[model samples]
Target: MSKKEVETTGHSWDGIEELNNPLPRWWLLVWYACILWGIAYTVAMPAWPGIKSATAGVLGWSTRAEVAEKIASFEEMNAAVNAELAAADVTMIKPGSDVHSYGVNMGAAVFRANCSQCHGSGAAGNFGYPNLLDNDWLWGGTIDEVAYTIQHGVRNETDEARYSEMPKFGADELLTDEEIDQAVAFAMSLSDPEGDGTNLVGGTYDVELAAAGAEVFEYNCASCHGEDGTGDIYQGAPDLTDAIWLYGGDHDTVYDTVFNARFGVMPAWGQRLTQAEVNAAALYVHQLGGGQ
Candidate 1:
C-alpha cells in the first residue's frame, strides 16, 4: 500500500513512522481456534489440578480408567483357565495337555516378571542364587515343593517360610581359624576325591588339611550339611559334593562361606503373585528337567 494510505501509530524513530500493521486475519482466527480447543480439551479430559487430586473432567475420561478397562477385559477372558490352573494339582498337570501348555507359558511370564531378577532370564542363576534348571536343589525339587517354596519363600518373615542358618564358625569364634581352614579343605575335597583339595575354579588347598577337617566337619557341620557333605534338604544345606555352588566353590569363596556363612533370600511370591501365577511358575520350573 502507498505511504499515504498506511496509518502510523503517531510515533517516529529517526524520522521513520511506526506503522500500526495488524496481524493477518487467518493467523488471528487460527490463534483463537487453538485457545477454544485448549479450553474444550480441559473440560473433556482430566486436566486441572486441585488440592487432593486433579479435577474429574465433564467427560470423565482418564488414562487410568482406560487401562483398568483393558485389564478387566483380559482378566475376564482368562478367568476360566486361570481358575482351573489355580485349582488343579500341579503334579497331575500332564505334559502336552491344555492346562499344561497354559501353565508353562503363564509360568514363563511369571518367572520373567518375578524370578528373573535374581535367577537369570534363562534361569541360569547368579552368585548366591540357585539355578532353576539344575537338579542340585538346596530344597526339594518336586513340583509341590517348588510351589510351596514360591508361595512361602526362603528366609522370609512368613512363618511357613523355609528357614535355615549356618553357623559363622570363624567369625563367631565357634571354631578356630585353623578349624575353619580344615573344614573348608574338607568341603572342597568332597567334590574332588582324587584331586588335591581343589576348588571348582582350580584354586588348591592342602589335601592334608582335609584329613583334620574331616573331624572338624563331623563334629561341627555334619548335622546340617550331612556326614558325607551331600547336604540336607530339610535344613537348606547345600551339597558340598556337587560342583553347583551358589556362592562359588573357589578356595577363598569357600573360606568366606565357612567364615561368615551365606544367606540368600527369595521373596514370598504368594504375597505378590496370584495363586494361579504361582502354580504356573511351579509347573513350568518342574518340567525344566531339574524338578525331582
Candidate 2:
C-alpha cells in the first residue's frame, strides 16, 4: 500500500507540526465505558464523603453491616455450647465432659484476647499482677470465687466490685519514720523466720525495731492482714508472711507502699462479656492448679 499523508493540526512549535490523529476507536470506547462504570459504582455503592458521614449508596452496602453479619454467624455456631455453659455450675462441670472441653477451649481464647496483656500469655503474671498459676490469691481461689471476681472485678466502677483500700501510714503521717521502719522490720521477719534480720531484702533491721514494729502492726494492720500477717480473704488482703509479693519485697518498695498505698483495678467482665464467657474463663483459670 502507498504511504498516506497525515494531516496536522494548525499549530506548530519550533517548526514541528502537531499531528491531529484521534485515539483508536477501541481505546476510546473502553475509556468511555470506564467512565460510565465509575459513575454507576458511585451511585450503587458508597463513594463520596459527606460532612458528618459517608454517603449511603443506593444498594445499602456497609462494612459495619458485613462485620456484624459475620459476628452473628459465629455466635450462632456457638449458641448451643454457650447456653449450656451459661447455665451449668462450673464447679460441677466434669473435666472430661464435652461442655468442659468446649468451655476450656473458649476460655483460652477469651483469656488470650482480654486477659493476656495484664496476666501474660501463660497466665504467669508480672510484678504487679497476681500469678494465676500459683496457689497465692489476693481474693479466694475456688472456681466459684473466681467467677465472682470476674463478674464483679476488683476496685472497679461496678457497685459489686471487690473493694479494699490500704491505708498510707507514711503518706498520712499516721506512723513516724522510726515506727514505719520498725513495722517494715516486723513484716520482713514474718516472711523469713530463719534468715538474719539485718540482711533481709537488701535492708537492715534490729530485734528491738522489729519488736516495736510488731506492736505497731498489731494495732494497725491486724484488722485486715491478720495477727500473724497470714491475710484474710474477706478483707482481700494478701498473705504478708509468704514470699510472694505483688510489687516487691524490697525495703524501699515496702516503705513506699506503707507510705502511699496500693490500688489495683480490674474491669468487670460481666459488663463486657456474656455469662457463658465469664463462667468459661473462671473454669479455665480455676483448673490451672491455682484454685483452692
Candidate 3:
C-alpha cells in the first residue's frame, strides 16, 4: 500500500506513533531468502516428519551412519592392539611389552573404576574386603580365582559368586572388646606360637578373657573360621591365627573388627567384559605373585 493512502493515528500514548512506511527492499529480500532457505533445507536435510522418514539430505548423511563411521575409524586405529590382546592370554599381558602393558594399564583403569571403592587404590582392601596385594586369600589365589573374583565377584549375590559371612561378634553381644582383644592377641601370638619373645599385645590375653573369647569364638567363628582358626576354604573364611591380615593385625584393627562387623562384596564382571578380558585380569592379579 502507498504511504499517502495509509491511515495513521496522529495522537499516540506514551509518545509512540504508528508508521505507514513499508519494509526496506533489503529487509523484504532477506525475509524472502529465509522462506526459500527453509524450503530448500526441508528438501535437502532431515528436518520434516514424513510417513516413512525425514529427507535423507543432499549428502545422504544420517546420525546412525555418522556414529557407525566414527566407531569404525576408532576400531581401525586400535585394530592391531586389539588383535594382539585377543591372541595373548592373561599371563602374557605383562608390564614389559608396550602392547601387554597397554592391556594391563587398561585393566588397571577398569579395576580403579569398578573395584577401587572396596579394594582401595592399591587393592589393599578394608577390614572385610580382601587385600589383593597380600598372599592371604579366602578362595584359592590362583589366576582362576582372581579372574573368578573379578568376573563373578565375592559375596556378589550372583549365582556363581563366592559367598562367606564373618560372625558378628559385638552385634551378637557374644564377646566384649576386652575379651575380643584377648582372642585377637591370642590369634596373633599363634602366628609364632614357639617364638622366644612375648607378643606385644599379650597383656590383652588374660586367662579369663581368653577363656571368654574362646567360648565366643567356638560359638560363632568356629563354624566358618574353624575351632583351630585354620579357616574353611570351602566357606571362603580366612584363618584368624595367621599373621597375614586382610585388613590389619593391629589391636585397633581387631577392635574395629569386633565392634563393627565386616561384610565385603565384589561386583560380578562377567556381564561387563569378554571372557578373554576377564582371563587377562585374572592372570594379571595372579602374577602379582600371590597366586597359588
Best-matching candidate per lDDT: 1
Candidate 3 C-alpha lDDT tens digits along 33-112: 99999998877877877799886878676899989999899769877786777566554455588766766666775667
Ranking by lDDT: 1, 2, 3
* TM-score of model 3 (CA atoms): 0.58
User: Which candidate ranks first by TM-score, i.e. highest?
Assistant: 1
Q: Report how far residue 224 has shifted in candidate 3, in Å.
A: 1.7
Give the whole-model CA lDDT for all candidates, comma-separated. 0.88, 0.87, 0.68
Error of 2 at 166 (Å): 1.6
- Model 2 regions more than 4 Å off: 1-31, 157-159, 197-208
Clashing pairs in 3: none
Candidate 3: where are CA atoms >4 Å away?
A: 1-106, 125-128, 173-189, 192-208
TM-score of each: 0.87, 0.84, 0.58
Looking at candidate 3, what is the lDDT of residue 204? 30
Enumerate residue pairs that collide in model 1.
none
Model 2, range 1-292, lDDT digits (tens) per residue? 9998789997999999999898999999999999999999999999999999888899999999999999999999989989999999888999989999999998998899989899999999987888999988877898989999988999998899999999989989999999898888787777876657743345445666787898999998889999989999778898887778888887788888888989989999999999999999998898789969
Tell me the lDDT of model 2 at 101. Answer: 92
